[model samples]
Target: MTTDLVVNILRHMLEQAMLISAPVLIAAALISFLLSLAQTLTSLQEQTFTTVPRLLLVGTLILIGLPWFARRMVEYTVHMFTDLHRYLG
Candidate 1:
């Protein structure tokens, strides 16, 4: 494949990665922020305070979003495979 093809694939991979991770990251960020606020209010300066809540929230988000993520991934995979001939030749 040419440099342009490689770059295009890399860009697509990055975009897909960002799309898949955005929900989880956003959920984690919100939970972490809230946890931090609570900790600050209570004067409970526990470094690990945000870990469990963030993890749980992100896990729940991942579970809820799994089907949609899988569908999108499969669509991208099929598209890439269908267009493989263009790159391979």
Candidate 2:
């Protein structure tokens, strides 16, 4: 493959990675923020207070979104494979 094609493929790979990861990352960030706020209000500085809920919520989100995540990954894989000839010269 040419330089431009290599770069384009890498860019697409990264974009797909970010798109796939965005939801879990966002959910974790939002939950951590909210939990931190609550902890600050209550002065409860316990680690588990933040850790458990974040894990639970993130896990739940992953479970609920598993199918969508799989579909996205499958789509990306299929797209890359379908376009494989272009890269193969």
Candidate 3:
């Protein structure tokens, strides 16, 4: 593939990756912030206390969004493969 095509593919891959991860990352960040606030207010600094909630929240979010995530990945793969001929000599 030419440099332009390669760069475009790489950019698309990164964009897809970011889009896929954004929800999980954002949910975790918001949960963590809320947990931190609770910990401060209660003076309860146990590591597991914060850890479990964070994991649970993120896990729940991922599970709920699994279909959407899978669809996005499949769409990306199909798109790349469908356009593969353009990159092949």
TM-score of each prediction: 0.91, 0.96, 0.95
- Residue 29 CA error for candidate 3 (Å)? 0.4
User: What is the Cα root-mean-square deviation between model 1 and the actual structure?
Assistant: 1.3
How would the candidate models be sorted by TM-score, starting from the highest? 2, 3, 1
**Candidate 1 on 1-89: residue-level lDDT in tens?**
99999999989988998999888888788788889899989999877787877877888888999999999899889989999999899
What is candidate 1's TM-score against the reference?
Answer: 0.91
Q: Which stretches of candidate 1 lie over 4 Å from their true place?
A: 46-48
Residue runs of model 2 more than 4 Å from their true location after superposition: none
Model 1 alpha-carbon miss at residue 88, Å: 0.3
For candidate 1, the lDDT comes to 0.89
Candidate number that wins on TM-score, 1 or 2? 2
Give the lowest summed-lDDT range of ten residues in model 2: 12-21
Question: What local lDDT does model 3 show for residue 4?
Answer: 94
Top TM-score model:
2
Q: Which ten residues in a row have the lowest lDDT in candidate 1?
A: 47-56
